[model samples]
Target: MRTVTVLGAGSWGTALAIHAARRGRPTLLWTRTPEHQAAMAQERRNARYLPDFPFPEGLRTTDDLHQALDGAELVICGIPSHGMRAMMERVAQDFATRDAPAPMYLIAAKGIEVDTLSNMHQVLAQELPPSHRGRIAALGGPSFAAEVAKGLPTTVVVGSEDAHVGMSIQALLSGDGVRAYVTDDILGVELGGAFKNVIAMAAGIGDGAGLGDNARAGIITRGLAEISRLAISLGALPATLSGLAGLGDLVLTCTGGLSRNRRVGIALGQGKKLEEILAEMGMVAEGVKNTKSAYRLAQQQGVEMPLVSTMYAILYEGMAVREAVQALMGRALKAEREW
Candidate 1:
């Protein structure tokens, strides 16, 4: 049986670990908090995040990083973008002295790093040793943890610079109700995953403000155009934006009720303070932070992302949500540009 280790015991991580374990893979789930590890081990569920879902019997829980990583052939990182680099550094240190085949790394997190403006894969490369860099891959698409845990049909894409890496991940992860596709456009996959959250927020804000279905549709459509432009600016394939990791995920996050980023935008549109909304959420909405980073990246790359800029203003500059919408609607008329 293949040994798989998933770092970070969040909802997504736990769901993937459960899937792997039920597939008869020897899986170890690592949680940074000992209390969480104990809770999962004793109750066979992650009460904090995945309360109702029972863990598979084949799944193991641990707080020890070294123990979780030992002899693992595949390591999936579910840590949030903010903490991803630190976690990778620790993983690198754990394997520093051991002379063994490097495990294939599957990054399950989606968000651009706020401080460095680096995507998940870039952060992985910066932290992991040179030999391990080529082993990195990213898993992305419109996947909700609750649905995946319930064994609902879910499709995702795994992408890497190396064709072999993408293919290998697809073979390992695709099974049962979960379908995995391979792509060589890792840049497009990662950017699409990160950028969609911001667009979802825009959609939620429109819906919450009672902006009508037409407005929501417009936001979703234009928001995708902006995402494709930004991704292309970063050397990503344009067609990749039309694939599962881009258009599919964008539609899901923007329209789905389970989206945390959309919920944050809804609260903002309802006139709730950002701090209060975030405090009540009790979960990290990547859009809240990614808006700023994405805005910065757009400016740095000379990409025109009016929606992302407006979101950054609303999120960080205290601009009213309705006002932001108006600004977007009132932009100078121009011919349709899909670049």
Candidate 2:
């Protein structure tokens, strides 16, 4: 079994650590705060994020990055998108001083950076040295943290440029209520995972506004097309978008009760301030920030993503949700198939 070190002690990170430890892989979960690490270490549970799930015997908590990275074969990054670059920079510094072989990176965070408009993989590539870059891979699909921690059946994809890397991760994470698939389209996997949150917010807006199932069905179907257009334009495989990481993840996030992005949207539709919603949730809703990044990225690529644009308007420009929905409905009709 590969010794695993999971960064970030959020719900997703904690769940993954539990999953790895349950597989009998010695796992170390790292949190930025020493107080949190101490609390979880003593309690054997992540009280802040995952109060219900108890840590397995093989799992440990740590505050020190050096301690977590030491002798680890696989490192799963669950940090939020905005914090990823800084975290990676710290990791790079640590790697530079070490003589040992670097561990494989499996990015679990699904969002584009607001500052640079770069995906998680690109952020890793920018921070890590050339030799260590090849070891990076991404994990995405419909798996939610709370469900995965409870040992529910979950399927996810591990995407890497190197087939061997993808296969290795797939083998390690498969079974035990988690089935892993491999894909060579790393960019597609990342984009699908990141952008789906945006669409989920849209679906939530429809639901909160009481627009009914018909409108939501339309939003989901058309949302996929918008995501596919942007992903394909950025050199992602069309097939990858239709696969688990794309369509599967999108559906789950849009409709599932556990979706934070959708919750944010619901609050927005219900006439709550974004600040108030975020303060109350006590978690990072990636879609809120991803809306800005994707909006700018699509415009740069000249991809028509009205959903993303509308989301940006609602979240940033103070546009009314109902008015935005009306505008979306009033747009010029075109052939269903762009080709």
Candidate 3:
């Protein structure tokens, strides 16, 4: 059996580790924090995240990155996007010191990097050694951590530029009520996963502001158009956006009660400060961060993304939610089909 190591001990990481271990793979769950490592090791559960799910016999916990990477056949990175480059740098350094072949990387994080405005795969390409870059794959779709930990039925897409790499991940992660689909459109997969969170925030804001389903449906439809425009501009396939990575994940995150980004937007719509809402949640809501990067990326790509820009203003520029509504609703009339 391939030994799988999951980097980061957040809810998603823990859930992935648990899933792999449950499948009887020898899995190591790595956290940079020693306290978290010790607690999971002793308790056989991640108290901070999934307290109800006990660790399977095949699962282990570690704080040392080197130790986790030592014999790993597959490395699943669940680290947040902002920290992806630094984490990959460390992984690259560790791989350089060892003569053994580097493990395949499965990036489970979603969102574009604010600093480089790069997607996760692009970030990995810049950070990992050239030889190992071909082994990089991304996991994205509508799987939530809590439900996944419970072994609920879930489907996700594994994308890679290399068909072999995508298939390898699909095989490794498929089973136990989880189905994996493979796609070669890595760019579309990453963009869809990243931008959907921003749109979900918009959905949540509408819900919190007491806007009905009609408004939400409008936001979702328009937000998808925005995502598709930018994604297609950057060489992504149009069909990929209509698949799991795009429409499926967008709808799930936008309406699901378990979505952190949507919840954060809910708090924002309720007139709570971003900082306050984030503080209360104590989890990474990728939308808040992605809103900034997507806004900048859209500008750089010369794509008009009104929803992303309005979200950027609300989150970073102190624009009121009411003002955002006006800005969106008051846009100049144009044909819905740009073509």
Candidate 4:
């Protein structure tokens, strides 16, 4: 019954819009690129991104911001983290024309800001009004767009500053196949989603190097410890890290074979150039961007995450992956547990 505005027409954005449309919501999806919007509108299919998934009849498409978000009861922002601030600024300028509505603002993006190192909700509060901050929520877990668009039995966490805000989102979308869980730890959910991409890349590198499951399991377990450590340092609940946002997402993205970031590392492990691998992928692999941010966050928080640091080096500093592996393996063995 809610008119949802999905403010991005990329793969994940279109997929989420399709889910809402399938639920019989009056969904409006927007694409900033005029050409993409036109194609999706004229063809009634987002062939560029969500191929084979037809845009539902009652669902709408637009290039104009005002037209898409106007009368929207829920705004689902699925843009990448790098563009989040700029997108919010453009939307904020347009918001001045309309009466301030208390619509639920959902962040479907999945990375921390590179410069500010802020979570998506913090980025929202910085760009939007203080009054709007309370309305902000995050939807994240280890969900592949293709699976979600196909109506797989997927479960995800909807987190907010208020437990009721998450519950409201749960009530808004709960149905037969998809399950939504509510939490009051938006920060944890967002960070877990962002950082897991980095660890998944590491796991992928292990797999590509033919290191076997023992190495991948080690990376996953240690990566989760670092995720929980960083999250707790930022005022998030430890249990939230163990939930869908942390452990569930880590398992899925690192080993699920659908992660683009993991695929990036796979090519790198096969001795492919970073530029070549990235060019072939032709997508926003968040781990490539998150590596620097995660390493920095770990350093600032005094959380020792050598794996994240070494991965950042491999991605940013021209360090060889083999050398990175040697360094990790050669580090002085301390207590296995950090807790």
Residues 1-339 of candidate 2: C-alpha lDDT, one tens digit per residue: 557999999999999999999998999999999999999999999999999999999999999999888888999999998999999999999888888787899999999998888999999999987888998899989988999999999999999998988998998899789999999999999999999999999999998989999988988999999999999999999999999999999999999999999999888889999999999999999998989989999999999899999999998999998799889988898888961
Stretches of candidate 4 above 4 Å error?
none
Query: lDDT of candidate 2 vs native?
Result: 0.93
Worst 10 residues of 1 by lDDT: 330-339
lDDT of 3 at 179: 97
Cα TM-score of candidate 3: 0.98
What is residue 207's positional error in candidate 4, in angstroms?
1.4
Candidate 1 residue lDDT tens string, 1-339: 668999999989999998888777899999999998998999999999889889887899999998988888899999998999999999999889688788899999889999889999999999887889999999989899998888889999999988888898898788857899988899999999999999999999988888889988998999999999989999989988999999999999999999999898888878889899989988888888889888999999999998999999998888988688779878888888633
Residue range 121-188, candidate 4, lDDT tens digits: 98888888666778899997778888888888889999988777778888776763578888888888
Better of 1 and 2 by lDDT: 2
Off by over 4 Å in 2: none
- What TM-score fits each model? 0.98, 0.98, 0.98, 0.97
Q: What's the distance in Å from true for residue 333, model 3?
A: 1.4
Instruction: Give the Cα-based TM-score of candidate 2 against the true structure.
Output: 0.98
Candidate-wise lDDT, in order: 0.90, 0.93, 0.92, 0.87
lDDT minimum window of 10 residues, candidate 4: 169-178
**Separate clash counts for every candidate:** 0, 0, 0, 0
